[model samples]
Target: MTIPLADDVFRAPGVELFDFPPLWEGAPYWLTKPVVLAVGGALVVCALAWAAFARPTLVPRGMQNAGELVYLFVRDQVARPFLGKDAERWMPLLLSLFCLILLWNFIGVVPGLQFPVNAHIAFPIVFALVAYVIKIYLGIRHQGLAGYFKNLMFPPGLPKLLALTLYAPLELLYTFVTAPFTHAVRLFANMFAGHLLLAFFSAAGFWLLHEQPSLVGAPVGVLSVAVAVAMTAFEMFIQFLQAFLFTLLTAMYIGASLHPEH
Candidate 1:
């Protein structure tokens, strides 16, 4: 009698359920992929920033020109409008955040570098936490702790009972939770979903072409390629939009913290 192996125990060795691995994998202390990407991206941004602004120029050239445009965009469009008189002081920080995030988002779309650093939640969470800290610090610096809390939780002119019931929860949700959570997740979710969808269709096209081995799969693959291109263009727009949105929300939060009455 011939012996048989269990189907579950014996299977094709090379088949994978999905083409890509899960986002995270267990690893030794220093080898985590997300950490590497975060550090690498940060270093690259820093280097670019240094190169861009190392030597001040009367007339900008190359990276300097690009950097100046980005700075003006953030300062004029985002910081100035929201922060007003105080915007000039915060221009550098705001511009850095915008460029860092914009670079990370666009890096995902580059061929051969498929992973978006922001698609991983940790990076965004860290940035959001920083924003939270800055907002709270500025709020307290501008208004003493008691005054800040009052401004936040008990805005003047509202009935005491209504303030307690309505304003408290709203303030708590907006400040302590929703602000950071939404700010971080908005970019993370967009990049994550966009990349996943692109991967799915692109891989499906390849699989169809391989399995069918005929002209039938060719058209489908062509359509998939077209869609992938379209989605890439859309992703570029989203990359810029998300970066700007993140910076804008950050400016708004800072503005609120600085002048909580508004």
Candidate 2:
């Protein structure tokens, strides 16, 4: 009699976890799980905002209190240090962006919806593009087109030859190409890796004891579950951090446009 190995009992999760088919027959290509979750995230954000701010009271309570905390966090930690006096003006955009992303990332760990919207490259790319467009528009409007490019590529007080030969080309490349790519990719990569890690441990726990209930496999299965629980908590923290970072970077870009670095 041949004894089965652990590999036979468990199938390791992979990139396949990120892929989803259409919900129903003849459904459009874009109407997959991730897309639906993305829309749901937006609606959830809107509802939260409405609940928190729809009717003001003499003193904040419940959802309003929660919303106020989130608002203050973004305003103080994200917008003000970067945007300064203009922070309030940009709060609506920055707050919405941060909350939407936080919701999307949290959904990855949700029981039924185990997918992060930003894990899909397209979603992050679209958000990054929005920030990029705003940055360019604000830069051009506040500072003339030539002045914006000058500040971006050639910072003030730099020596002429080195600025032209060394810094200018690199800065131009960073501003136009590298910044936006990294902006989206930073969020995408984090969510992708986190979700993949969670799926792997989850599958390991389920498969080890359930599929092949053996003496040796039982302890390992329990350990796998313990690790999954720990990782889930850690992943939640990471999800929140990634959302903050994405929004912080967006604020930085917008701030840089309005007031170029010296």
Candidate 3:
């Protein structure tokens, strides 16, 4: 016989998923789940690369094939179009960026480790800042300091009068201020919101069935679980898309830095 609690016992999920408790009692609060997951993701990616390329081969076998797929995907889809003939020069950087982010995003969907490293905000911000710094440095290197700013602000095909009056300040603000802000926020917002949605439905299911322990709540619990399952699958797609988008934007930014006139 099951003892039934009030239906109100089944409250919806809170932000607890985002607020992680320290895994060890003595550990600093900052040394939490997300940090562990971040390190784990990095190690996993590195190990995969090592295993795939540990032995030189005339033809790829096993993990090498999968590794090659990832390399080609980034090289052809991401680097080629924007970087053009110089795409090969940047392959290593772009590949690392894409794979690291993809793994971090996919961590949220993994069973027993359902956390997105990028959801923490600071992770994405750091990546955006690093890429932004590299972008500015490359721009200044390719085009002198004054030339870089001038080319960025005064795009070709614009009339000189309009370029000086309206476009210069607007371009300055857009390129310098808004671009990197959006770059960071875009990845952060998606992962944060997606994780929240998953947490809500997952908690709802648990609360509906376990907390209240009622026959009446069972159907709702089942439905919530189903929704959570569907959401996880959808989240995987989103993870891939966001990772791809982030890499694509990085390439675009670097391309812009290289050839500001374009």
Best by TM-score: 2
Winner on lDDT (1 vs 3): 3
Tens digit of per-residue lDDT, candidate 3, span 49-140: 99888884879989998999999999999999898988999988899899999999999888788888999888999889988998999999
Candidate with maximal lDDT: 2
What overall lDDT, based on C-alpha atoms, would model 1 receive against the true structure?
0.78
Model 1: per-residue Cα lDDT over 146-228, one tens digit each: 98888888877889899999888898888889889998999898877776766656665555555444586688867877887
Q: After superposition, how far is residue 211 of candidate 2 from its true place, in Å?
A: 0.6
- Candidates in order have lDDT scores of 0.78, 0.89, 0.87
User: Would you estimate the TM-scores of all the predictions?
Assistant: 0.86, 0.95, 0.92
Candidate 2, 1-262: lDDT as tens digits: 0112364645577777777889899999889988999999999999999999999787999999999999999999999999999999999999999999999999988887778899999999999999999999999999998998888777778998999999999988888899999999999999999888888777777777787777998899899889989999999999999999999999999999888862
Model 3 stretches astray by more than 4 angstroms: 1-7
Candidate 2 has its poorest 10 consecutive residues by lDDT at 1-10
